[model samples]
Target: MPRSPSLRLSVLPLLVSCLVASGALAREAGDTGLRLLHPFATPTPPGAPNGAAYIDITAGEEDVSLVGASSSVSEVVEIHDMSMEDGVMRMRRLERLDVAAGETLMMRPGGGEHLMLIGLEQSLQVGDRFPITLEFAERDSVTLEVQVREAGEEGQAAGQHGH
Candidate 1:
């Protein structure tokens, strides 16, 4: 049986909508709801055993915790925070860094939060890039490409907000 032109046209939009909605759902399933911005690492000298990577991460509607991280360039990847205790500076590993819903967390050098890459496999040079995976407590891990920049260069400095 031949269908009327009006019926076919109406069905087309429904079909298209279904396809679009399904695609959006598929993407939502894989999405961690975390956004990474301006991820970079400081260049290290030849034979330097350690380095750090910094970035800004924004949590989505649901609260998430950054529990750990991993990288191919370093044997040990740890979340660290630095603070002044009394008159001395101290840095320590963080078991987990929380990101509340709708909050943006900035990981900057000389600050309270950063990723510590220890036992580096090779020295990082300016313009070099590597991959690092960020683990979250309630979502799938996210892998990002990190660029190596000069030690004094701060990426996305003005955008720091909400910690």
Candidate 2:
């Protein structure tokens, strides 16, 4: 028996949705309702002491706080923020970053909130992968892989979103 054309078309959308979801940078943090999206770090120069990483964090029913992060590539990972004040760029170390309920904290390069990988044990090259564990205040910790990519690389594919 041949399937109806309408049925085939309906299934095609579903299939496409699944494929897109699979490629999207959406990863839930345990049962805490925290989603980490598109975590990536830019390649570092040789013997560079520091590097930065960015990600998009979405909160669920309740607010969430990101206290700190840890990775083997760096000796210390600090939650930091970069902003322009008085026509000059300034960077500050944050003890914790808060994300409101049903809101997102989008960390990007060049400005805003970012993860500072200090005292790097090695220079991060393009295509290198590593794991970074995030600790949240009063919430379970989540470990996610970070992908190394060049600056301005908007990740939307499966491999670009990391492991």
TM-score leader = 2
Candidate 1 residues 1-163, lDDT tens each?
Answer: 7878787655654653453343221112133355666678998899989999987778778888889999999999999998999988788999999989889897777768999999999999988888788898887666667778775655443345322
CA displacement after TM-score superposition, residue 9 of candidate 1 (Å): 29
Give the Å shift of residue 15 in candidate 1.
Answer: 23
Q: Looking at candidate 2, what is the lDDT of residue 114?
A: 97
lDDT of 1 at 45: 90
User: Model-by-model lDDT, in order?
Assistant: 0.76, 0.81
TM-score of candidate 1 to 2 decimals: 0.75
**Per-residue alpha-carbon lDDT of candidate 2 for residues 1-163, written as tens digits (9 for 90 to 100):** 8878777655654543453345444665544477888778999989999999888899988899999999999999999999999999999999999999899888878899999999999999988888887898967666667789887564444245454
Where is model 2 more than 4 Å wrong at Cα? 1-25, 155-163
